[model samples]
Target: MKFQLDEPQGGNTIHRHDTRSVWVNGTEHRNSLLVPWQGTVEDWRLTRFEDLTEAHFERIRALKPELVIFGSGSRIRFARPQLYRALIEARIGMETMDIGAACRTYNVLASEGRAVLAALLIED
Candidate 1:
């Protein structure tokens, strides 16, 4: 995928490439990253931890976000031991929360200049 960066003066700045990936400001996202009190994306990459693996990790690892917010479905559950260990070993910060909560949290952290990676599953 080709990634393009767009810097907006205000609100959430979205980066678009084709249609597979998007990033709000510097945050890494599969779909889109919503800025707090800003807005949301029509189609954002929303996923559960169970849907991720080392391969996914490797792909996202390239972004080098300080914290990766994992929306574990619509609930909060501890991430798999394997993933947790691997993420920690890679010095990647991980946050587990509900999908909606994750999205909100992601934007806040990203807007604050935190290296944030978000995986949120949202309903249209």
Candidate 2:
């Protein structure tokens, strides 16, 4: 679905998303990516939810977002606590959802000027 909103001047915002891809700032990205509310988008290099590791969570931790929206591809799959123990220890909040929901939530939080990160996994 396409999200109708004026793009914020600096921060990243999801403009559209379907099952296969997500559009950030009008650019379509088909692979996994990390979208920070106020930073450059980067490739997440995670193809599946199972690929998630402590190191991956650590990377998100380094961004220091107050909340994280984890898009577990096409469905809602919870990750083992051990995979993201660092986030729990750091007191950062994380919510897991399907990719589409994650996109929508990310847009809302970002528009509200919240420090949020959307770690979305898009299947090939």
Q: Write the per-residue lDDT of candidate 1 for residues 34-74, one digit (tens) a residue.
A: 23323343333334445556655555455566678866555
lDDT of 2 at 106: 92
Q: Name model 1 segments beyond 4 Å from true.
A: 1-49, 121-124
C-alpha lDDT of candidate 1 relative to the true structure: 0.54
RMSD of each: 9.6, 3.5
Clashing pairs in 1: 31-45, 46-120
lDDT of each: 0.54, 0.90
**Alpha-carbon deviation at 103 in model 1, angstroms:** 0.9
